[model samples]
Target: MSHSAIRRVPASVQSLRSRAVWLLLALVLAVAADAPSAASQAQAPATADDLKQVQQMIDKGHTDEALKRLDELAVTQPVVPGVHRLQGQAYYAANRFSDADSAFAAALVQDPHDLESTQMRGLTLFRMGKPAEAIPLLTAAHNWGPQTRVDPSYVLALCYLDTRRYDDARHSFALQYGFPPDSASSYLLAARMLFRRDFVPVAKDFAEKALALDPQLPLVHQLLGEIALAGNHLDEAIAEFEKERARNPLDGAVYDRLGDAYSRAGNYQPALESLQRAVLLEPYNSAPYILLGKVLLRQQVPANAAMYLEHAVGMDPGNYMAHSLLGQAYRSLGRTSDASRETQTAEKLQADTEPKLQNVK
Candidate 1:
């Protein structure tokens, strides 16, 4: 974190407005109220109490005032210990990553062995999209063995993935979750982890490795089918899903996926058969009933579609898609008022859930 390396990170406050932020603020207060560490004790006794008060202000969502007090304290005691680290924590809480980096760097200069500073600096660099710079510090922090509940291993894995170091990511993830580094489950875990980040080709390769290691592995074929379906390779998806059905005959989700592929390929007859089987296999699941209703609507059987959709809506009142599709069915059946009511309900639900859906953090 040299002067030249301290660039402002483009972070959005809205993206990080979850309960995690609240917990972190609370953590600041909790840690500051604890007995002072060696760093805090190196300063005058008054300075230590003052720093604790600053942390209280930050915990109460007063970064601006907390920072002002820290500046005053630094002016009074030019060589005060742990001041820079407290400043970094305040900046981080305020979403000021560039300032946080500089403060954390200064703390490290005074005490290079500060594990908390190392971890915070690594996280700040990561938020600035400097994963290459963050890796060494995070690796060091990882070796410190859970100093706090917040694990740096997950961020390290993301760094490895972002840099396309698939092998490193696999090892890191295995270490994080206590899996054997070369085990089949580790490869599968890595594959799904990559898939979640939209690295589909690498995910497919790892999934292939998982399958090779254990031919009887469950969900491997289903994962393959999902990748194929995402790419609109309907024939491949259907084939892979059929193989998964063979491996997991009692899995209703496989039948539902199979029905979705058939419907996408305009094979409504096969779609109806698969969906019916899914419904029978999962009698209480609203998902199969919804898919069945969709297939029926596509087949121009509005009465049957409405019946299944009504049952699905009854089971999951908050499902916007079911409400929307039920609205369409009602419209087809000339039930104008019922269609209008369902449409309004669906729109309201969609609007209410949009913020949650867009919350990447």
Candidate 2:
């Protein structure tokens, strides 16, 4: 998926708490401990035997036991350079984020230039919903050198994305992927990053380069479709989405985009079919439901529109567009009180978001 597609929190749903939830989920999937092995701890001036033992326990997947041993060592050797670092690794492996964060912090105090501790601490802070604190540590780790294993650059890119540092995120992701500019994947990734930053013209240039390099690249057509949609070139968007569908028929996001394009092009029947397919493919996503409601309303099927809009609102109550559309549907169905309530809610949401929208530029 494109970074723009993933990171584009709906304007109506732009709350830090909500964005943090999504970011934390991404961090959990991406971040890993940059733990050094026993033989690789040459620079550490700590008790080598204890470090070696901790690494053995971690390697054997006995994280709990490793934590217990680290705790024992900490009571006697609290200022040991690598001790807390190893403890952080064990705690991270055990999914104890708070403990891991503190351990990493302690390790950094003892040895400020410890790259593994720095990266692990940054990753821990990110997982703990502290992206601002993670940024400097991650940047330092990234600047240190190439990571042999468990690169922290991806997590760092995500931190930049979460913090709305678009240019930094783009650079970090490019570094993480390490693809030459001529590579199709590199072009596509650059396109997605630029798209997220609202640099649509530049994004289109990169997308075109990706297409020129490999027309059959998995998401290149989808990126083009998104660009076309952004420009309100409905027919062009539909054509690109159709090409994507031909290549990846089972992708729910493609169906959702195609359905949206069809609806905008006044092809209601096809829009309904495409959206229904999207719902079947990814039932949890609310976009298809919202689009289905919209198409139904356009088709003068207010009753059906109300049903789908209700589902959309149920799934994502913060979606102001869905609320507004549902209000229209309810008014058409002669549900005056319900329509009034939904309309008022939508208006309030729009008013609340107006300031943020104005500040976007």
Candidate 3:
């Protein structure tokens, strides 16, 4: 709980962070990118260091201080290159979207080739819910020189999706990820992306479209089932997962998801069967092992549950769910000391991973 504690992230959470940061670095950290170099280019020698310090301030969450320093810089050179961009960043970090948009616009006006300014202007507009107004700038800046740290095409696709430009959205998304825009796989990719972004209803439509184009497309039914499962439509999820099973019998993931759906529906026997199949098919993953342990625990077979859980914990030591379930199994078996240790480990793992998981925002 201490602020200065040495933080450690679980491997699972690290994977999530890497995925989220790609999208996030574009939307948030893009403004803060390469500040030292940007400052070194075209400025009074004194102002160069000043800009660096101000950017450091902004990066440290001291936006107010950064803005005040930028104000002093403005007084020295009202037209100083990169000053407005820094101001825009400070405003952005401070949640002053309108001010950020104006500052980035001023930076663009001063130097039309300021790719950072152009990209930030578009992003600020998007943050302000002006997706339509953001398209042109985002489109132009997505491929600008001194290329952005992450593709701006990600947001451009979202903007297109928001404005009901499905074709454009799909095209931009495919371009960002190198998928063929007209293929069934493209729509499937869009649906997966949209599903993760919480555009679930729209995601379902795309998934359906993918199926329409190619009924036997791999994972399309699985994606549909995943959407239904997320929406808590258990029967629908089971139906879709069954359809997926019919199409791709060798996919261990389908069995894993089907087992999860069955477990959630309290059909423990089938859940056990499906999870056991998943365990055989996906030997490298610990998910089915953990789920199998839970099903055993639910059936009051603590000894068996403990065996599976121990295997799961060994496979993924940082998995708090596995640790917590192992604690339950130990408690049921009256291994008081062992139960207490696992409970403590589960708590520690959960606490350690919470902050990293929050980084998804």
TM-score of each: 0.73, 0.56, 0.69
Candidate 1 lDDT, tens digit per residue, 69-106? 78866654564777788899889888899999999999
Which ranking of candidates, highest lDDT first?
A: 3, 1, 2
What's the lDDT for candidate 3? 0.89
Tens-digit lDDT track of model 3 for 1-361: 7754558668899999899989887877666776756765534433577788988898899998888878767754556788899999999888899999989988988899899889888888988999999999999988635635446888888898888787788888888878889778889988987888788888999999989999989999999999999988999999999999999998999999999999999999999999999999999899999999999999999999999999999999999999999999999999999999999999999998875544322
Q: In angstroms, how far off is 155's CA in candidate 2?
A: 9.7
TM-score for candidate 1, please give it.
0.73
- Per-residue lDDT over 75-188 for candidate 2, one digit per residue giving the tens place of the 0 to 100 score: 653456678888988888887889899888888888888898889888889988999999999888975444324567778877876787755766677787787535788778
List the candidate 3 regions with Cα displacement exceeding 4 Å. Answer: 1-72, 89-99, 128-133, 161-168, 231-235, 246-250, 267-270, 280-284, 314-320, 340-361
Question: Residue 66 of model 1: what lDDT?
Answer: 88
Q: Kindly report which residue pairs in candidate 3 clash with one another.
A: none
Give me the runs in candidate 2 sitting further than 4 Å from their true place. 1-140, 143-172, 178-182, 356-361
Worst 10 residues of 1 by lDDT: 38-47
Clashes of each: 0, 0, 0
* TM-score of model number 3: 0.69
